[model samples]
Target: MKDTKILLLLVIGVPILGLVYCAFMIGFLLLVPWGQNHPIITAAIFVLTPSIVSGSIWLISSARAKK
Candidate 1:
């Protein structure tokens, strides 16, 4: 029962956090017009943003699995 709750929370929470994080990154890109001038920075953010979120989710899920 407890694990189920934790899993449920993880399922619900990670995506929300990921989306929020991605939104924030995008907003940062928009606000920082300098980012538009630099393709590398923009590309880094676009690529790294999903990786960071998915990596975090994977870490959490793996940790939970170990438990």
Candidate 2:
């Protein structure tokens, strides 16, 4: 039962936070002058950062579950 709550939090919370972060980043990238200078970096940050974070979380959780 406790695990169910944690699972639900993980499923719902991470994505909502990710979306909010993405929206903020998009706005930041568009509004800031520095953001305009490097389109590739901005694009990569939007694309890669979340995958890396989520992948790391998944790896740690899976490892914990195996124990």
Candidate 3:
């Protein structure tokens, strides 16, 4: 029961935090004229950074699993 509640909180809270962060970034991009001008780079950075980070985490986890 306790574990279930903790898992439920994690499921709900993580997405809320992600949404809030996205909202802030979107607001910042809109507020900054440079963001409008260099949208491609900004988008690439946002999209690729997560991909790279996930890939790195996956590699580390896989390596640990092998050890």
Candidate 4:
């Protein structure tokens, strides 16, 4: 029962957290000027940063589950 609860929490929590983070990033992006230089780097930073965080969380959780 404890393991089931933890699994349920992870299933629900991670995506909601990821979506909230993504929304925050999008809001931040909208505030930036359109003519800013290095748009590619800015875009890459925005896109990659959250995925790295969420991916790491997912990897850690899965690894712990396997142990």
Each prediction's RMSD over C-alphas, in Å, is 3.9, 2.4, 2.8, 3.8
What candidate 1 gets wrong by more than 4 Å, as runs, is 49-67
What tens-digit string does per-residue lDDT give for candidate 1 at 1-67? 6999999989999899879878977787788888768969788877887889879999999999999
For model 3, where is the 10-residue window of minimal lDDT?
42-51
Inter-residue clash pairs, candidate 1: none
How would you encode candidate 2's per-residue C-alpha lDDT over 1-67 as one tens digit per residue? 6999999998999899989997899898879988899988888887898789889999999999999
**By TM-score, highest first, what's the ranking?**
3, 2, 1, 4
The lDDT of model 2 is 0.90
Model 3 agreement with the true structure over 1-67: per-residue lDDT tens digits: 6999999988999899779868977996999898889999888877787689879999999999999
lDDT scores for all predictions?
0.86, 0.90, 0.87, 0.81
Q: Which residue pairs does candidate 3 place in steric collision? A: none
Regions of candidate 3 where Cα sits further than 4 Å from its true position: 1-10
Model 2 Cα displacement at 64 (Å)?
A: 0.5
Q: Candidate 3 lDDT (Cα, whole model)? A: 0.87
Q: Please, what is the TM-score per model?
A: 0.58, 0.70, 0.71, 0.57
Pick by lDDT: which candidate is best?
2
Q: Judging by TM-score, tell me the better candidate of 1 and 4.
A: 1
Candidate 2 clash pair list: none
lDDT of 4 by residue, 1-67 (tens): 6998999989999889879977876776677675155578877887798789879999999999999
lDDT of 1 at 47: 86
